[model samples]
Target: MTIRVVVADDQALVRTGFRMIIDARDDLEVVGEAADGEQAIRLVRRTSPDVVLMDVRMPVVDGIEATRRIVADGAAARVLVLTTWDIDEHVLGALRAGASGFLLKDIRPTELVDAIRGTARGELPLAPSVTRRMLDRLLRTAPRMSAPDGLESLSQRETEVLTLVGQALSNAEIARELALSEATVKNHVSAVLRKLGLRDRVQAVVAAYDCGLVRPRRP
Candidate 1:
């Protein structure tokens, strides 16, 4: 199936560039484009694309709010946030708002295409250096200290899956490491989120760290 994408950025050139790059690939196509978050949502609702490449600093509305509404509505479209700064707080907000992942504005065309593909599969993108610092600071600033009631209900296996998510493992990679099928890993991850009352994997990652289910690597 072709991966339909919606490109939403204030700059017409950026959106056009992304559309050309994505549409050039056999697996991807730009179904629609928008200049701001509000328009992006409307386009997403209209097209129901598989993914959205959203800029964090758009006018009228920001990407974080748009992402939050999209996920909250349980739309099928995934969000891939774009930012100019490394470890920008808005990046965290976007993720917490249900973005599947993020990309640097200067990311190579191939990498950008790959990020869209990965996010459609519910996987995180390639921002390990920036992401690591973001996750660490998030772990410290997060207010999940009291622990949600549903979080305590996770089983041992479910807990493990959440920890791996916190460590940034994709479902396929998690399956390989745990000697399980990708479907099974996905199941566990889903159950973990349901039990934790989380919005998506990004929140799952934060929950794992906040609950001390995983530790960050020392820099």
Candidate 2:
């Protein structure tokens, strides 16, 4: 199936560049383009794309607010936040606001395409550099004060899955670590999300950190 996408960035050049890369893929299509968050939201409502490439620093409404509003409005499109700064707090805000993934602006074209596809598939495609920094900040700022509500609802296996997810491991990686099939790991991940009342894997990651199931690596 062709994955429809909307590229939302303030720079016309960036939008055009992304559009070119995306449209070159047979399975990907650029259905709309927006120069700001509000326009992005409007395009999403109209085109119902599978994924949205959102720039965090866009003017008027900002990517975080746009993501929040889109999720609040129950739009079907999953948001994939893009930013130049890997450690920007706005990236975390965007994820918390319901973005499905985050990527640095300098990501390779192949990786960006894969991320878009993965986000559409409900996979969290956070960049490794960004993930470490984001989680470190989360650890320092949010700390593991207490378990998030609904955490206890997860079974032992589900908890394990959540822990791996928080560590930014993909389903295949989680499966390998737990000696389970990828399909089984996928089911466990779904269960973890459902039990924890998370919108997606990004929220699951946050929940994992919040519940102390995952911790920052010691230097």
Candidate 3:
């Protein structure tokens, strides 16, 4: 399926550059552009892009808040935060606000295209270290009253699959580790997602961390 994307950046150059890269891909297309955070939200609402490439710094609203609002509005769009480094201040906020992943601006064009496509399919671009860091940040902050409701519905085996996902393990790796068939792993992943009402693997990871199924810090 074609993945519709919204590029939200303050600099005209950045937006233009991304548009060129995305539109060049047969599987990806840039459906709209936003020069500021407010415009980003508006455009996303109007266009219903499958994924949003959000700049951390914007004129009126920051990408973090824009992501927060978009998520709160119950949009199915995935937000990929753009930052200078993988671990920026807004990176944590955006993830906490339900972003799929954060990518540095200096990433190669090929990787950016791949990451956008990944995000469109509910995948994350985060490394294990970034996932650990974001989970640590979440642990340090005030605990929330809830996790994404429905984790309670997961079976013991499904919960095991989700914990591995939170740790950034791939399907085959999880299958090998769990001594289960690859097909079984895929089914478990689907069940976990359905039980948690999450859109993708990234959200599943986030839910796993918040629910204390995975430790935020490595031992």
Instruction: Tell me each candidate's TM-score.
Output: 0.85, 0.89, 0.86
lDDT of 2 at 88: 74
Query: Residue 118 error for model 3, in Å?
Result: 1.1
Clashes of each: 0, 0, 0
Candidate 1 lDDT over residue span 87-174, tens digit each: 6778877876778777888999988987888778765666444555667765555455544468768888887888888887778878
Which of candidates 2 and 3 is the stronger one according to TM-score? 2
- Candidate 2 lDDT tens digits, 174-212: 888999999999889888887776777877887788788
Off by over 4 Å in 2: 126-134, 137-148
TM-score of 3: 0.86
Ranking by lDDT: 2, 3, 1
Give the TM-score ranking, best first. Answer: 2, 3, 1
Candidate 1 versus truth, CA RMSD in Å, comes to 2.8
